[model samples]
Target chain A: MLEWIRFIFTAAFLAAGIFILIASVRGVYKFDYALNRMHAAAMGDTLGIFFVLIGLVFSAPDIWLGAKLVLIIVFLWIASPVGSHLIARLEVNTNPIWEKDVTAARRTIEEGDTHGHL
Target chain B: MSKRNSNWGNTLQGRFLRWMRFGWEPMDVLLIDKMSQDRDESVNDALSAAENLRDLQLSEKYNADTAIEHSIMQELDEWSLSKGRKIVNRLYALLSVTLCVTVILLLLETVIAMPMRGVAVSPTNNEVSQRYIEEGMEETGAVNIVAGMILDYRAFDTLGESTVLFIAACAVLILLRIDRDKDGRPTQELIAAEEDDRSHEPKSDRILQGSAMILTPVVLLFGIYVVLNGHLSPGGGFSGGAIIGAGLILYLNAFGFAKASRFFSYKTFALITLLSLSFYALAKAYSFYCGANGLPSGIPLGTPGSILSSGLILPLNICVGMVVACTMYIFYAMFRKGGI
Candidate 1:
């Protein structure tokens, strides 16, 4: 009974991770802007990976293996954010027409105010 | 006399007919002129009718010829499109069938040649392997038979493999290395282009730089540990060197070549690779000579489990590790810039 319960939990976690990763991939294709695609990819990199690794740890045969799995999570957590930040910076630097694709903060507020006034 | 008169009468009759037909009187002359004019007109009319019939025939024949030519051209076009497509499809199908047959035959040959698993007569139970299993540890002085085999028993092959990698790196360097002036300054145009490229690329993010700085030392330490402990553990020079090389690359990406060059320059890469490879060659040559001459190499095989043990294996692994790490870094540098 306990084994079956553990199996179910692991499967559920893995499935959820897979679903999130798939959704992120879809979002990447659906989003028009590079920044929005990056946002979707970062979610998969962090949350999807986390869930999958957590599930793997539960199914690991030994303590050392489980510890290594957790270490991978920690390393990715540190690495992915940095990677995402660099990519975002790259997108900002390289894209000359980024302003047209994404609205500026000041313009967004003014537009909202105009709408309210109307 | 009467006969003569009769002959004269016949002559007169002929004469009279001639007078009537060729009479040159005024009325007779007018009648001849009218008759000649009518005859000329009738002849002209007949000639014109024949000419018109010839023209109609020529036009009908031309129309039939053009229609036949057009139909033939359309048929040729249809043949080229549909018939040509069918021919191409047939050629491709034949090629695929040939390839599939050849592949299947090759696979079947391999399967037939393979020894049955678990049979005593299998290749795995051969005398050479039996000896290796029984005496490899003692002969090589390493607990890990796999490492001992690679570093000692088959060290020449490993050396060759390493040299292949070195040559590959050299080839890439030759093809892609940036040309510098006598003063070691990169060419002005190349520098200008690089500057333009860098302007478009993002500068290092603070978070990325910070994380890389923190992780760099740890990663390097781990790589060293793996390299040093290769003989006694699961990890070896290849994996360890790859890790260290990756860490170095990550640092370079975060901080850029200017910062990374302080520690690892093109000169440094060249020197390390040259020294390590030379040392490895000399060491292996000495061991091979000793082994061939049935003489001990005089290098002590210290206690197997200790870091300093395994005679030449530890040093060899470190040399391999250095070569690998430098090669990886040089490869990355060459890809990024034309040179390190």
Candidate 2:
């Protein structure tokens, strides 16, 4: 029963990993802008790795292995978000879409404020 | 035409007629050919002039003068380097800097390595132990031995660590803090701009905002738990502080910098930092004067397995946690919108 549980957990994690990889590729191809692609990649990095870690925890043979797995999960959790934020900041600074037309209603409000204040 | 050519060719006249048709002949035919050749030469000259004018126009349009000037400057630079006294000065400067750097580096390496050479490990409770015995386990009802050690055993260190955090916060604030002219008071213009920007954003994205809202509480609770139980577990000041910092980062990322700033202001942060540092220093001083001639008397190491076992670890942990959380948030805020 334990072996079956481990096998199922492994399969599920592998499937999730594959799914995230596909989604990341699709997102890269489909996204209109670099920022949008980055968002997709960040999501894949955090969620995909999380699923894989959970699977590792379940598959580990002993408590020590499980604890070590948890350490990896923790380390990744801390590092991943910071890495994503840095990348996003770099992208925004270097390749800002200044000429692109704003579609969000918030932009109109901002424009109104700028003109009205002056 | 054949009869006329045959009669003419019988003598010089015939030879001249044949030469006039195919080669240079000295007579009226040669003069006519020379005039045509002069006209053709003038036409070719006109075409060449037109080509030169076209090239000049292109060069003017593209600002080729600037390119030529740049190349000329580069060549002059090469010439100067090859023939001038500046090269010798530069070489001397390079040699001096290299020697200075090598000497400085060697001195630094020796200084840094001196402490590690043939060192003796002496067990002295430098502030940490003193605080642990005096304030940590006794004051805070925490069990884990290490936690007790952190919270009570070295409460002062926790305080100093927190002060370090407070200093970091102040540094970040000073570094990133933008000067604003609000109502003639020096305020951050960037903060005003950020505020204006945030106000323009819509509040209708319930799904996105709601998840962040939910996560904030959960993460905060976990952070507090880590801080509270620091004396009893592996997680202490640094870890708890980092966790709280992470929580703040998450909140800021989801809700934006302006909203996060509302919860903590520069004045409040400054006050907290000052208070934490003073509290830590005062506590240490009190312990030093009241205790055995500034020497730490080991606290009664209580039942080893109990929550209150390590005397001062718990309080120290709390202090460290607070300072770490505040510093981390300050750093994040400064990095995000406040000019770093």
Candidate 3:
């Protein structure tokens, strides 16, 4: 019964992770700008990876392997956001049209229109 | 632009052609073009003076000679560079494809003739491989069989690999490192490099700095852990050194070269690489000599699975890690800023 429960949890988590990854890829195709794509990829880097790895750990052969997966999760979570932040900075600093897009987004935010652009 | 123009404007290739009109990455595709303005002007002036001199005398022989040379050059360009080059390229591609197909067919034939799987009398299950698998732990005292093979039985080959990395780092250093003269005035290249640096790194970033502060130590520590546990676990010198080098690069990116130079410079890189490489060679020499002479070396291959086991493998792992880490950092520094 416990094995069945664990299997169900693993399947659910894996499905969610796969869905997020697919969404992230779709977002990369849908988004028009680099920052938005970075936002999409960062979602996969954090939450999608978290869910998949956690699902794997749920059915790991050994506790050590599970702990290693957890370590990978921790390390990636710590490392990936920094990389996304750096790439975002590069886009903002390098792209000439970034200023206009950013200011327009800020103006929208001021008018109580919430966008996840920033 | 490519030579072919079969597609009009609808395809991805056409789109690529349209969008690829910008300058090269970093906008410095022609370095000497920008560096020798005075020389170019001087050459132009000298050519014009010679032309004026020729015009004053009106040398028919010189005019005829230049015209003949120009016509020859144009003919050569038309033949080799414009029209005939495409035929040469197609012939070369045909030869390459024939060779590739022959090789693929030969390999496929060999594969078809190979024995079936799950058989007891397989080619791979030899006495030599069996000895390595069974007695490897007892002989090398490494829980990881691959690490034992690489660092013990094949130590000299790994030594050569590390030496190759060191030499490559030296090449990069010679190619990219910007040096100052006795007077310490920056060269034209150094000034240009500084300008490039300014454009890339306009300011010290706070977010990067904070994250680096939190992550550098952890990364470095993990790298050390990996190097130390090479004989016991999966990771070894090359991977661990890469991690350490990555951590160093992150720290460098956050704090800038000013802080990195305080602890690490060209001299430091030289010293560490030199010391590590020489130590590895000398240690390997000692072990090899002992094994050849049928004598036990004084160093003990401690119990397997321990961090301090595997005789000289631990120190050798550390040496390789140092060399790799330094190589990685130096490559980053030289390429990024043309310094250190």
Models sorted by TM-score, best on top: 3, 1, 2
Off by over 4 Å in 3: A30-32, A62-64, A99-118, B1-110, B113-122
Stretches off by above 4 angstroms in model 2 are A1-43, A60-101, A104-118, B1-160, B179-208, B256-262, B287-309
- Candidate 2 accuracy as TM-score: 0.52
Ranking by DockQ: 1, 3, 2
lDDT of 1 by residue, B294-319 (tens): 47889888877888888888888888
**DockQ of predictions, in order shown:** 0.32, 0.04, 0.30
Q: Which is the better candidate, 1 or 3, if ranked by TM-score?
A: 3
Tens digits of lDDT, candidate 2, B134-189:
66444444555466454444555655566666766777777777767757564657
Compared with the true structure, model 3 gives a TM-score of 0.75
**Docking category of candidate 1:** acceptable
lDDT of 1 by residue, A46-95 (tens): 99999999889888888899999998898899989878887886786557
Per-residue lDDT tens digits for candidate 3, residues A3-43, read 99889989999999999999998998899989999999999
Tens-digit lDDT string for candidate 3 (B267-288): 8999999999999999999899
